[model samples]
Target: MTKKQEYTGDYPEKTLYLPGPTEVREDVIEAMAEPMFGHRMDRMTDLYTTIVEDTKDFLDTDQEVIVLTASGTEFWEATTLNLVEDRMLVPTSGAFSERQANVAERLGKTVDRIEYDWGQAVKPDDIRDALEASDEGYDAVGMVMNETSTGVRNPVEEIGDLLGDYPDTYFVVDAISCLGGDYVDIEDHNIDCIFTSTQKAFAMPPGLAVCTVSDDAYEREVEKGDSSWYGGFRRTLDYYDRKGQTHSTPAIPIMLAYRKQMKHMLEEGHDARDERHREMAEYTRDWAREHFDLYPEGGYESQTVTCVENTRGIDVAETVETVSEEYDFVFSSGYGDIGEESFRIGHMGEHTVESVRELTDAIEDVAGL
Candidate 1:
């Protein structure tokens, strides 16, 4: 068992069970080891085009796709700048959803929101009422499909149905944590723009943000001349249409990993991947109910991550630290105000039900509840 490679000093790695930056396959990591190439080269075009088409196929959407060398947060500003000409009606269900509304406000756009409790889902009727009540009308409605903070999967499809009456208001969704793992029919749901980061359900490394844009969203960007320079929908998608490459220097290595991982995703097929996530979610929820309660409202739990209420009166921070120290594993504490009252177990990406069991077992051993 002698080592072939010399060991390094102070190199400790914890198994990530967080909502994002999930476990990645070794081959995907090695994909980044390929020789570097010029961004404008033909090889780069092949790499970028393959990933883009593969992403569309994986998502089962005909909408144009944009891959940027940034986190999912980039699209928050991009969507606001490009589409929200007057007001954006955001539904605040959790931290990430609130952040989306804040991004619009910071960008100097008028933002209205339908507020909900931390773990409640957004109501479609409430959205309809908000739009109906807005005298100035709304340019876009922002929502988060999977609220990473509270583990609530808001009713995106239901709200999309309501938005059909208001075609002027574009539907923008943040599917960052559940896009690849969960099933969301973007076109059928009437989504104008949806965005996700690779590290989440894509099971890839960070540094790449993938988005899909409908034709209406593209027209809105064209009409709004002062859109974001770096993340402009037309500026990025048009460059790809003409040259099959990004408008700026892209994250070539990460995209290389994206190309490899996306192939595995296609091979597994979308329906099967989504079913696997559902299985993991059900297993985790059943386990949670055995010892604690779910933080999100019943029948609206996220299929990618589960937020468990600390009904056992355990010290959440201490429990997380002890699990990491003893099991070399890590998960998330409840977000924002609920940090001390709950903890999160992320079952997205390649996490199987058995993998979830390992962490839950360790948690039981550490907390002794």
Candidate 2:
């Protein structure tokens, strides 16, 4: 047979295996394709406002929602700039979780941390003990809701519960990879600040970030002025309050994409989408154990994605390349430091059991073990 002809936007693309930019549903893809409008007009603000409202419900927060044009990293900075003062306590288990310490130091806040083994969830007991043991008494306890680098989902609610005794210490969570993929009840966790990116479970292309800030966190930022200027929470909150818009010109197209994607997630029903993720993860994990072992332990694996340890040691990168050529699906080989001996398989967005089996079959064939 001759090589198949290809044309952009003419044919539907194959599935994605990467952690983000996963397969988007047809309805969502078409939602962004709807008519464009002036960003300065009432239409844009209305769209933006809708997203903020939708995000609040999705995150289960009664907090103020902020949408930015940059990646989730920016929102991470916004949290420190917005409310964090003096010192913060972080429990780092993976690359991204450790990164919060770096950002906090750069933002001129003192940091304390209770370290956990890589690819392991930080236990609620340890967090509670740390909080009890610390004489300095941190103002905030920060953690990643899910650690993508090592395929671990931290117990955010459990950790947040540890902070209840210290009412002044707010709980900050990085829900970058877990926001829409699972349920996050802000009131239950007493989360003062939570941040996330658009590309993961939201099933949209990268470039926009979202966060919900509690009134306590907002007031804290007001008490500590000038932590940051541009893209800072204080100014953005003021802008939103004044005219119900971003402080600067927004990323109109990405916001448009978000509006469409959020609608799709809502239509899919929260319980159903979450159940799909759980079921897909279960299938993928069981299959992976038959051939290759998972990087993280049972009960701690990320539901939206899985990291396969390079136990086969059979040129994981080359196997990915071959599978991509024949199967038209691709995912990265783990994240930093762990990339050499591991690979990730994402099941977020529209990825299903059939898609996972397709990729798994390709892997078993290519690896020949």
Candidate 3:
């Protein structure tokens, strides 16, 4: 029999530079330690409503927001079940976007993909071509705003604008890694549904997913009559309208943390946060260009995470380990097929350009850049 190892809760505190589970603020962490309350209690309602409304304000959107105790992946399934009745269009660029399409397929929906190279962006023209080429109408068109695996930022706004032409086809975007940091005009862009995770640009701990649902998308789910019980827009939003809490029991501690972090987010302001992230991305890309090269195509790079091509052919895994062990700075190697060929640096979530340079400096020291 195999023996299980016990956790001692003693470990080196390394700064996170990975795509997700990014470094959360100390106060946010402390907020999670608040006393627990019953889900039905007024305190729970206060916590839930605060975060939901704050999120709407943070995004500058009038669309209904849903906060659930799940990863951003939950919306991949939820959007599929709610919006896509029989067919959806997904433009595959990187791992995350591909997975979303796969989720729809697994739900027994026919998924048509306009494939792009991992580092290439999803073009709106291609989406238009796909829609025009198809004789049958699609129920939804889904795409990832930022492909974390390859650092490609698809032009979701352009696609959303084009989707406006196809009124019958709803537009759903998985903005899990860039939503809070990137300034997306959700309503102006005609996006039907957009979702994200707290751990990414929100700079909070994992276990909460946030999404904005347009009235059209919500009504479509209602008409479908067969939707995810836990993730249904009708179930969650209607319950919030009546009880001011999640339909299911939520992670109250995380809600506490969310409330705290959201206050910080509001103070920072969405446009300011977007500019900060943009500066970090510019700095990271400059550094990458100097020492290595960027993995993603030019002009479509992600602002939250930067994937550096291993141009100098340094040992990515070894350098990551050495930086963590020696400098207590943790970054990420490339994801999936690009593993070892590239490395990723997460710059979102409370991290400034000065702090990001600290990791790059450590990398240069360890990798002999």
Best by TM-score: 3
- The Cα error of candidate 3 at residue 234, in Å, is 0.4
Distance from true location, Cα of 240 in model 1, Å: 0.3
Put down candidate 1 lDDT per residue, 1-369, tens digits, no spaces. 876886676766788899988999999999999888999999999999999999999999999999999999999999989998879999998999999999999999899989999999999989998888889899999999999999999989999988888999999999999999998999998999999999999999999998899999999889877799889999999999999999999989999999999999999999999999999999999999999999999999999999999898899999999999999888999998999889999998888998889999999999996
On lDDT, the stronger of 1 and 2 is 1
Q: List the residue pairs that clash in candidate 2.
A: none
Give the poorly placed runs of model 2, Cα more than 4 Å off: 1-14, 33-36
TM-score per candidate: 0.97, 0.92, 0.99
Clashes per candidate, residues 3 or more apart or on different chains: 0, 0, 0
Tens-place lDDT per residue, model 2, 1-369, is 899877567643557888886777676666666676776789877988888888776665678888888899986677777667788888888899999878988888998888887888888888788878888887788889888888887778877766777888888899888778877678777888888888888888788888887888878777777556766667888888877778777878778778887877777877788888898889988887887888876688888878888877878778888888777778778798777678889888777788888888888888897
TM-score of 3: 0.99
Judged by whole-model lDDT over C-alpha atoms, candidate 1 comes out at 0.94
lDDT at residue 306 of model 2 (Cα atoms) = 88
Q: Which should have the higher TM-score, number 1 or number 3?
A: 3
Model 3 alpha-carbon miss at residue 172, Å = 0.5
Model 2 has an lDDT value of 0.81
